[model samples]
Target: MNTTYRKVIDRITAQTLALTEKNREKLSACLERFEWAKNDLLLREGQVCKYIWFVDQGMIRLFYNKRGKDLTEHFAYEGGIFLSLESFFRQIPSRLIIEALEPTVVYGLGYEKLHGLMETEPEIEHFYCKILENCLILSQQKADACRFETAGERYHRLLQEHPEVVKRAPLIHIASHLGMSPETLSRVRAGLL
Candidate 1:
């Protein structure tokens, strides 16, 4: 990891300073990169998720299928974290589906290896705990935003928070993340401009 990622690691864990040099070395060694094409299903519903991913580039969505409709629950872009959380955590089938929105490169760690690392490295454990906490917070925020925010408000907030995504992702994927139809998102954007 570079100084930048080291800083990210530190920010993710308040008690990270106690991690031994050997533990840090292990973390570096476990990091591995994988790539997938647009529309690739990284983990399908009812499948066991194998890896917890950190996005380096491109985009992914976590969604669930219900009555033949896809309900988008989360989106991960560059510098974001992603995984089928329930499957990754509980070692069971996941209801959520993880798919790439564009060609993506992700740094991934297997569940077993991550658990072992967490047991041996307090910092790694704390880091994961923080990750889970942040994920929960974000999930709640997304739910609230979609339920209560106007389309324009949601779009503007997204532009402010993830400007890079506005440039990199297709408009339809952004629409899905915003909990709007593509046409509705277009109208909202036009109205804002």
Candidate 2:
């Protein structure tokens, strides 16, 4: 396995579940790597997501179009994992689209293969559970932020926590993700919001 890929797996496992070398090797076997160019579409609307993609470098975004406007839902950069959760679990087409925001390299673990391993490998099962728990927590935090924080507060929190996203994502997308208009984001960026 590539060191970058292995390191990502290790990072995800950090303090959550420890894997034996043999188990780690088995996990690594499930990861296949691919490089995507800037602006490449990793997952399209109506495509069932089959892999959990872990970025080794660069950035990706999950978004959907509504009334012909793009609504950014999430962004993940290096060392981050992303998937269309419902689509991956339910084997249904996703309403969201995923795209590479920069020249990107990712390792994808097939949903079916991983689930199969989970059935037999207790550690893998535990690891999968940990991942889901983390994802749920993060999802709730985002929902809470949207429900309770002002746009400026939300933007500032994002800047403080994931500056990479603010620095790299398009202003329009950032604004959309924060549930505000681009002009609003501009004012917030200027400290006027």
Candidate 3:
């Protein structure tokens, strides 16, 4: 396996339940590397998300269109995973669009292959379940932040927690993710400074 793929596997093994070497080899075989340029769309609205993508480099944004405006829902950077979880699990069309914000390298596991691995290896199944749980927790946290936190508070929390986002992502995208206008985010940043 290449270094990028190795890095992705290492990250997965570290984050999820420990996997035996045999299982790790099997899982690594299922990963396929892909490269995307900035502005490339991995999954568009209404399309089924076919792969669970592990970012070995660069960044991705998950967004949706509403009233002709693109609203960012989440971001995945190096060492992160990006996928339409509901669409991938349920085999339904996704309402979100996933796009690369920078030249990106990813290792993807096809949905069918993932299911096969889960069925054949108990450890893989456990790992998959843990990933699902984490995804759920993240979703809930985002929802809570939107509901209870002020825009400035949300921006500050994001800076503290995901500083890569503020550093790497465009200001406009950061504003959208924080549920604030560009001007508002600028004011918040000014206040912080």
Candidate 4:
């Protein structure tokens, strides 16, 4: 592999390791690197998601269409993981759309290959468990934000969590993710001033 490719995979292994060099070699060998540009579709609805991606650089968004409108569900940035977890794990068609929000470099492992690695490498399994735990925690936070927070509060939380998105993404995109209209988001911003 090229040096650039090795560096990116090394970064992913670092994150996957959770600061521990447990099974970096096993995980590293199975990884593949790919680059994508802003607005490019990484995974589409109805496609069987093949790989679980690790974002080495830039950002990605996961969304699904609702009444012909794209509803943003999740955002993964540098040092974050990106995958259609349900589809990849179940080996079913994906219901969500995954796209790069900026020019991105990613390291991915095919679902089957990842499963094989986990089974063969106990330390890899530990890293996988940690990644899943992060996923679950974030899912729970999103659910709680939707249920209990006001629209403005939820928007605030999103900004707090991903401040770069406010500058990088279009206002409409942020509005949709927050389940609010652009006008409402403007008003909310004004109210804070």
How close to the true structure is residue 53 of candidate 1, measured as C-alpha lDDT? Answer: 78
What lDDT score is found at residue 40 in candidate 4? 95
After TM-score superposition, the amount by which residue 12's alpha carbon in candidate 1 deviates from its true location, in angstroms, is: 7.6
On residues 1-193, what C-alpha lDDT tens digit does candidate 3 reach at each position? 5655656777977876788888787888889989999999989999998888888889999999999989999999987877898999898999999999999988898899989998878889988888788888888999999999998899999999999999999999999998888999999989952
lDDT of each: 0.78, 0.88, 0.88, 0.80
Q: Per the 3 Å backbone cut-off, how many clashing residue pairs does candidate 2 have?
A: 0
Which residue runs of candidate 2 sit more than 4 Å off their true CA positions? 1-4
- Please identify model 1 stretches exceeding 4 Å from their true place: 1-20
Model 1 pairs in collision: none
Q: Can you tell me which runs of candidate 4 are displaced by over 4 Å? A: 1-10, 13-22
Across residues 27-80, which tens digit of lDDT does each residue of candidate 1 receive? 656766688999999899999988877787789889898798787777888678
Off by over 4 Å in 3: 1-4
Q: For candidate 1, give the lDDT of residue 143.
A: 88
As for TM-score, the candidate ahead, 1 or 2, is 2
RMSD of each: 3.4, 1.4, 1.6, 2.3
How does model 4 fare in lDDT?
Answer: 0.80
**How well is each residue in 1-193 modelled by candidate 2, as lDDT tens digits?**
6676677678766635788887787888888888999999999999999998888899999999999999998999987888888898899999999999999999888999999999999889888877777777878888899999999999999999999998899999999999999998999999997
